[model samples]
Target: MSRDTGTDTAGMTFLESTPKKMLNAYLPLGAFLFVLLFPFYWMAITAFKPDNELLSRDGNPFWINSPTLAHVKKLLFDTAYPEWMWNTVVVSVTATFFSLAASVLAAYAIERLRFSGAKQVGLAIFLAYLVPPSILFIPLASVVFQLGLFDTRLALILTYPTFLIPFCTWLLMGYFRSIPFELEECALIDGATRWQILTKIVLPLAVPGLISAGIFAFTLSWNEFIYALTFVSSSEIKTLPVGVVTELVEGDVYHWGSLMAGALFGSLPVAFIYSFFVEYYVSGMTGSVKE
Candidate 1:
């Protein structure tokens, strides 16, 4: 009877301690989630608030008095927003695809082939990435003008690949090295050509790394301001960053509402891409570590 009572107390204590352990485990995660999400939440709330309410100092900080679609409508309708968005999309997609294609081939060559000066070439390309775009853009601008591609989306597409491909190649080289060579040997024995093996086996296996590199390239091109501002002087060819800043502010007067809306809208696609491919992004970032 005393033994039964002791067991009952012990079980109750264990159950109580379980909740405490669970809380301890979840507390840090909860805090981190709040920290990361709070700014986005604030931006979203501000985006919905009426201009008057947004400008008001006495109103609720977290909640808006009046929510309206005026800002969103103005951003979409009253500006070169569509053209800017299209330019960004075109440049980002083209740059990402070209960068990935070039990087994969370069990486595969470096990892699989024993060519003279291949190592030196890879090192040179990696070093190129360290040169700031600020410096490169000046010389590149002259070249673009000489090539008659200035103030054109084509110029941006052409220039972005120079920076993107090298870094992506180096990243993928590390990842490719991590893949077991025995797999390639077996594929070769099975009568698979180099192209067939790369397309069927190597590429499929390197999807995560490819996705990471592609995302990096896409985001870099999409958010780039200096190049877009320098190279694309025409409003028609301007991307979101340059277009939004240039159009939304008319000297001393600022279009805060539309600016905020554009920022939020511009960021949405990137956020979606990251969310959907989160696992791949994580794997790609970590999987390249060569032991």
Candidate 2:
């Protein structure tokens, strides 16, 4: 066998040029970065910008000449922003916990229980996630009202699991399927109960999958709008997304500074979490791809 050393050397030479690298790699990345980050940049600048600069067309819209803490102060003091943040945290954490617990059980059962029609059952669960929340919200509204859970954190916490459990279960099923069956069989031979195997053996190895599912579930619950709007009516119980949009903007007037401030602050936690778990997230996603 002959190696195509000339072709390889030519390809490497082409990539070695700074201009070629800039055109092929940096340019596209620059565009994508600009598009992805512009909104956040705008939001950050708008939060600190004085009203004159924000509204007036006389100066630079991209940078603030004089930054002010007014928006942050106003957002924290004038509205139920703090309450909204607390409510979002509570609902997201509670719902994510319930959904993950249920998903782990369902995923393990489907992947490990050796049940009849297991593949079909797993497909059905994933398909359930495809159904739009908009259509489900109307019917869920009736159920919420009948159960007297309307306008409360309990309403959001419980209803969130409907959408959350299906996706989490599907994600976790892929992860669980990747585990070697021989390991599970070994556990069984050692007289470990199914629950013990799940809690001790499977869960320990599936940490990345759990983190991915949790991050997704928590983010969904945090930014959820329709269910938050439908189930919650009170300012105190409203989550960050709903509270920021509804309370910050009066019918005809928009508090641009405060609105941007609320958005900026509201997004920080999610960003922080993504930065922290991004490795596990990528691993969990690619883990299923390999299986």
Candidate 3:
């Protein structure tokens, strides 16, 4: 009886013990959550903190002593932040729309059309995505200048697709491949045209993939800095990322409160989008289809 009891205890000890579970699961999860969330927490607190507390080294930096809305008010009323936000939304939406439209056709063609050199073409598209924006931006800047689109929202709307299209195409190609080809064949046998087949059968099933691509494209366009900064010079045409950085700081003087406020507000929309469509995003990324 003693020997049996010892064996049972040893077998159960490491994997099922409370302390071991805490160490292996809870502790690691807690650490990850802290690391992931600490920056946003800091940004939120800093946005609301008064200048005195923000600048002073005396009090607990983690906690807000006196939260105020002055920074937010200034950001909204005293600056071109509203215009910046509007510009960002407009440019991002337009670019994502066009990118998705083009990518859908490209991905569907490459994946379903059985065209010659399709794989090579798809490879070329993915390779385009690997090109760093920093290098590409220079020539793009000259083109924008030549076209006299400098300091205009149109420049960014057009230029963003240069990067957005390749990535979205690559993503959607993988998704389109996961879909069963027999669906298209069945539609074809029933005398459906290619366009009808694509519109009716393929698109309905690819909603998650479309949303996922849109999310990625929109986020990239929204947060893009180099093209926005290079192509747009006017405050009214600037996107949130560039506007906040340029307008909030003055030669070694950082407006920490207003800067944090801008960042926090700008980030909220993307976070909300991700949380809302996370299910579809995951499904799309996995590229799995039910037959």
Highest lDDT, which number? 2
lDDT of 2 by residue, 1-291 (tens): 013233456445564689988988889999999999999999999999988888999866888899999999999898999999999999999999999999999999999996899889888887787888999999999999999999999999999998899878988988788789999899999999999999999999888789988988888888899999988999999999999988899887788999999999999999998899876656545543443
- Reference-based TM-score, model 1: 0.84
Instruction: Please state the error at residue 65 of candidate 2 in Å.
Output: 1.6
Return the clash pairs for model 3, or none: none
What would you estimate as the lDDT of candidate 1? 0.82
Which has the greatest TM-score? 2
| Model 3 Cα lDDT, one tens digit per residue, 164-245 | 8988888888778878989999999999999999899999988878988888788888889999988888888899999998
- How far residue 146's Cα lies from its native spot in candidate 3, in Å, is 1.4
Ranking by lDDT: 2, 3, 1
Q: After superposition, how far is residue 274 of candidate 2 from its true place, in Å?
A: 0.7
Candidate 3: worst-modelled 10 consecutive residues by lDDT: 1-10
Question: Residue 49 deviation, candidate 2, in Å?
Answer: 1.1
The better-scoring model by TM-score among 2 and 3 is 2
RMSD of 1: 8.1
Error of 1 at 36 (Å): 4.3
- The RMSD (Cα, Å) of candidate 2 is 4.8
Ranking by TM-score: 2, 3, 1
